[model samples]
Target: MIRKIGVLSISLLCLAAITSCEKDFSEVGTNVVNNDKFETGEILLDVEITPKNIESVQADNINASISDYWLGVYNNPNAEKIEASIISQLGYISNLNNKDTDTTVFNLDKVILKIPYQATSTGTTDGVTRFKLDSILGNPDVATSIQVLENETYLNTLNPSDPSKRNTFFSDDEYLGDNVLSEGGIYQLKPKATDTTFIFDRVDRSSSLTGTTTYKDTIRAINSQKLKVPFLAIPLDITKMKTLFWDKFHSGEFLSKEAFDDYFRGIKIVATGSDGLLIPLNLASSPAPSVDFHYTISEVDGTTVKDTLQKKYSFPLAGVRNSHYKMTPATNSAPANNFVVQGTAGKMAKVKILGLDLSKSELTQQFKGDFNDNLNDYDIDDNGFLSLDELQKLFNYRKNILKSNSYLLMNDASLTFYINQAINNDSNIIPQQLFLYQNKENETGGISPTQLTDAYVDPTSFGGTLKKTDDNPEKYTFRITDYISKLLSGEENTTTDPLILKVYNPTDSPVNNNVLTTSVKSYNWNPRSVTLFNGNESANGTKRAVLKISYSKEK
Candidate 1:
């Protein structure tokens, strides 16, 4: 679906007389409605997201103040990078606008776009993130709805997290081996690699930029509950850092266990703000020089944004790594998904479950009207579990939707059930989701459950041998949409179909067999006894049935 991207928001606190110049990213209690004009005058440039590297591009269809612009991405296309100038060449800013608008007059190879991974498609999000990736990859002029984060945030200096000096989870811990060293906010490295491949490191015992005032920035988890602590995670692949951190200083020395532990526990990195964060200014490599504005809010006359924040980097001169680093404005869909899901799981169960992404399709609509309504619509609730009956019906309706198949036993710390209602039609209302699993207790944040024992079925509603053949193979995706939809709708039992299995194999002629009955997934909730579907007691030939999926780190 087409998503809105790249909406710039700035801080403009109107005090009595003097204009208050707010720091690069310090929020001084400003109203979003009152600052539209101010944001227009200011052009933000991210040096890290260069014209040569931008994978998603932006285009100006109609030039009007506050009028939404279109994003036009060109990967070797004729689209040009932003051309910034100090003073408006046409005597005013209008002249500069004229030149920028004219560049697309002749041969602007405009095409609809869809955002990929990076500003440059290399996979790393280290550069500028606020820019909309959808514009770079999707439709040329579709009104975007994104709030871009500022990259000009400045702070004092940075110093590495010394275990002895700090007290947070990332500080004061001894790391070991090639295994990802730090758990929550740390990593270990050895065997120095290229700066781009592994740039800043504590593994090789090196610091690129060193001075009294450090330039450090970070992505901190506010409320701590929102944290995806690296080490404690189930999927081991979350430890994405592979750049070796071998310290040649003692490369061949005894591989002493004691020293190894110390090296892991003692590495630190002191990065600075303002410098390391590269942003593009008005499409030009250069940015206007920054001045000390000391922007302040003497008073606020309107609504007090409640249950909320005023968090920032350490007081103009201190370090704020955990929850106070500068952040790029966003909520971009694709990149956000990249951070939450890995390719393996997505390829397995997500992207294909819905003949079209019900949520995304509503926004983009390109894949609409191409599905078999007979196929139970699939969905994955926020909790991540599929509906048993709906899933079975989907396969029956589109029985040939599999290239290969396998039953998953996900190892989870917790299981939950809930109900929700559809937003639009009273007749169209469906349950939100039926099942949810947590891989880790800590990662579960703190959800409260109403009941520990709930009865439900999980075997195939329409089943046979769930094995794949060489020819009748088609790729399939697994999604929990059915479960989520059921949970949200609060329509109990009505959505669940009894578990049953049947087989008709070609052996000279068609031979019928009642292979399995009772949903296997339902048995999983028991948390105790093992369920066996295909046994000698059954009158049919042996055919296996899977009860429930386990929740564990995918290998």
Candidate 2:
């Protein structure tokens, strides 16, 4: 039946049909008004990362003022032989009580070299004895010994700025003095605690009948305990050192500091014998690391000695130390999913992020953009401005405007590192903490001399110690949310530098750049853990380093 419909009824039918339409109107019609309110949603972006080899770095080029520098020797079974030595300048020693050690008055007793161990208290019963060593790598079961020799090398005499003269000293150089102060094998090395005693008063507070506390008889008890410290006490020969001191004293030549250093060159500490023990010693202790000279000027009344004058002289000194490492390529029995991470002066593990092409088309495939690849199609620019045409690209699968004039916010971003436990399972050799840095590779493919990042994430919030999980025992995670945000926020550029990893040194660093230019680096050595790469099929399939990022867009 043909029925006549009113104009209002036809308009109502057209409105209903347009509301039910599911096709995207923005593509077909240019004047379509998108009044849909913006909504918020989250997304996860995946980044592929791979590990690469890093070059060896000079250990001596570091800040010298701080005591964070290392001094020791360790021979790695699969890698290089590590050795270190210190050179110091002696301070002026005036005659004590107007008495000089010349032709008549003073008599020498003995000279002792005291080297303190790197130790810390764990709030345990033994206190200092229960303290743990900071950087005691390798097995401690084997026997090891240290030797002390007079260093005849004159460092200040050479030009200070010349790298070859001031910084190029090595382990094989013949820069030692003829006289050996303390021979090796003097102290047998072990990782056991020493006995210590403490006294404390016992206080008893109990409730009385009136609900008040009452004091009982107080008693002092002595608590004897032991702590583990890596200390070395080397006694120097009095006959040899005494002769050297007398020569300048009798000639009335208390010479200048430079002449004094040249006359009695600093001591060189050499470690040998056991391959297991190469521990770092603290050279910046409170008493100021030194050599103590014990003497007695005795006055005899009869055949028996009546007045025995006991006196001790200390030579306080401070100087730079040098580390020598003979690193051999790591020896792997079977191929694994990990690569090595080592550092010292400037050593690092270089890594490359894979499967990411920054081209617009590739970004579109991953991001699924609706616009064209050119500037006319894309909405965002280097200045972070977005056009209305760009806002249309954020439509959801339901063809709803999910985003408006808004910006993307990073919720979480992290880099996960998997350790090859099969190859590196030694507990002693594990790196305690790891650090992330910019690659800063120069034109010659080498890292710059001073390449530390000016910007750093909060240590408590980001990259730190490795985490142990039942599923992935050797996993290390780094929080890169702030770092990635900087890149997206136009604070940093990816084209300028890549990423690298190093061992984290816990010591407080000196802020002065001049000190870093001259001192030697002791800590931050090879951590032996390698990063797993993509496309490399292992027993457990392809294990790759991954950057997992979570972001949200506000409507």
Evaluate all candidate structures by whole-model CA lDDT and list the values in order: 0.19, 0.46
**How many residue pairs clash in all the candidates, one count each?**
79, 11
Report residue 114 deviation for candidate 2 (angstroms).
1.0
lDDT of 2 by residue, 486-508 (tens): 44333333332566666665332
> How well does candidate 2 match the true structure in TM-score terms?
0.64
Q: Lowest summed-lDDT stretch of 10 residues in model 1?
A: 522-531
lDDT per residue (tens digit) for residues 246-324 in model 1: 1122332214434323332221121122111111112110111111011111111233211211111111101121111
Q: CA RMSD for every model?
A: 32.6, 15.5
- Residue 32 lDDT, candidate 1, scale 0-100: 21
How does residue 332 of candidate 2 score in lDDT?
A: 40
Deviation (Å) of 17 in candidate 1: 64
